[model samples]
Target: MEYLLFRLYGPMASWGDPAVGSDRPTALRPSRSALLGLVAAALGIRREEQSLHDKLAASVTFAVKQYSAGVLLRDFHTAQVPSQDKKTIRRTRKDELQTGRLNTVLSIRDYRCEGLWVIAIELTEDAGWDIRQLKEALLKPKFTLYLGRKSCPLAAPLSPKIVTSDCLRSALDTEFEPILKDSDADRVWLPKSDRVTYYWQGRKEATNLTGVSSDKVWDDPVHRQRWQFSSRTEHSASKHREE
Candidate 1:
């Protein structure tokens, strides 16, 4: 099987998880919806293009090799908004501010600092776009790409490459240039573990790694406009590395 491979390295990344109230949490790895959104942005697909988004979603699956989950960082934000009134119509921020009566809203956001992950994208049977086309789009994305949020801009190049492998694990094991220099790693506290983790979706046979566990995550995109997502089973495995 052929896969499109790339590296995502940034100072901060926010892989969104299920949100509750004003507190937003992040997952350890990038969600499927976030990966698809990255591809759609690279291909210049807009949010309003529902048909196109649906086709793309059905056309590909994802795998991830997590190098560093990064350190957890939390932020607090407070913003002022106009008081809610059903009778009043505020077209923009300017109009809302003009109301004079304002309310303060508080939100807590979470992030992963200095996170790194290698992503593997596999084309499905109904794939409309080939690996080469996707590679080129990623090389020169039509729209700017960010890790997960607009504030978390990428600190390194994606370094996309196409490789053929017998299984998903082999594709993910393909190496690229290191994100950080030896000196940088020594000076800064880069997140690392004795065991490396792998996550993938699709049939077990597709990913040859064994002794895996499964869990349901609600990251599957159903509709971008409506912000709807469906749950899907994800498989994971971990291996210990020699110190």
Candidate 2:
């Protein structure tokens, strides 16, 4: 088995936190969709091919490292007024665009700073190829990859190899723990668990992967929608290997 590991980092990455309405919520960590999209982009797939309407099968895993913690809140608003062209029964372009310009606002409810960290994305496959070759393929300077959202940027492609569950666990624990002093709050109040792990295995029905689900993926209503893809015969060899 070979896996491609990606290291995601950026000053400000939006992971779409769980929020309501059209207001987008940012993840405190990286996301599967963002990672999958990066892979698709690297493969030179078009936007239409990446749409949820198109099903693509690829497995992914996400490990979140929270070096900093801050509370987030969002708000939304919408209004419909009389159309400028009464006879046409259509709203003007300006009105439509500004209708909800400030529809959402985010504020950090709390503050905790950890500073630096790393999140590993393990993309596994049964392909009979060298992991080093895959890593080399990803290093193409023109290759543009994103984390969960367009705003999130991956730092670099890291070496990928078979990782033991224990090793993964230790890495998460060591880097995520905050050094609390006795003077700190009695409860120490660490950032909401600060560590998350995900594992995705390719499934037949959709282009999306299945396996370990994340609260960020499932609990968020906006992410509840699933993507669909037509399994074309062109990639039959890859498909067969995955199966």
Candidate 3:
């Protein structure tokens, strides 16, 4: 099986909640839909294409790395209102104003410069898709696609190979070297290790400092560690479906 991992990062990123309306928006952690949309746009798929939706059901995950967290608001410029000509006013009474025209203005709110998040998309194809094809499609000069927000662009290259569980663990350890280790031969796990799921937000305790023993400090939940793991079960299923 093959996969595509993206290292998403930028000055600002806004991944909205699925329940938000067009006017009112709320930012949430990355979701499956947002990631799929990014992949679709990278592949240059049109909105009318059904294949993209069908192909997205395979196992996919989003690993968000929060370097900084903040919010931003923007104003809306364009809005329309009812005209007085040939328009019936909904309410006309002694207590109500007789004006037939009403003006309405709208504003847009969004998140501004925030931290970076790495989104790794795992794509499994049995027919054997080339990693270079995925890379070329992503790094194209005119490509304007993004995982969640326009400002948030991919960080690392798209690796089109299934990353093993051990490899994923090792990668995280390597990325966060001193934090995950106390000494050359002794590595200690945090107290909140069981909650070490994807997108775990936890505070870095004092023990998390360099040269400190893991037992010397308390474990505070601040931000969760985000990682992706794929196993043989998924590999076999993806192969059967493709065939």
Best by TM-score: 1
| Tens-digit lDDT track of model 3 for 129-217 | 35556556666623466646665665434332334333332232223222233463254322211122223112223112222111121
TM-score of each: 0.93, 0.46, 0.49
What would you estimate as the lDDT of candidate 2?
0.40
Q: Answer with 1 or 3, whichever has the higher TM-score.
A: 1
Off by over 4 Å in 1: 181-189
Candidate 1, residues 1-243, lDDT tens digits: the string is 889999998999999999989999999999999999999999999999999999999999999999888899999999899877999999999998888999999999999998889999999998999889999999999999998999999898999999998878888889898767987987766667777788998786666766889999999999999999999999998877541
For candidate 2, give the lDDT of residue 182: 71
Model 3 C-alpha lDDT versus the unseen true structure: 0.40
Q: What TM-score does candidate 1 get on C-alpha atoms?
A: 0.93
- For model 2, residues 52-156, the per-residue Cα lDDT tens digits are 313322334444444443444333444444334445433465656554432333333211122233444444463333445445545652357754545445443
Off by over 4 Å in 3: 1-3, 19-22, 57-59, 74-78, 81-102, 124-132, 147-197, 200-243
* Lowest lDDT block of 10, candidate 3: 233-242
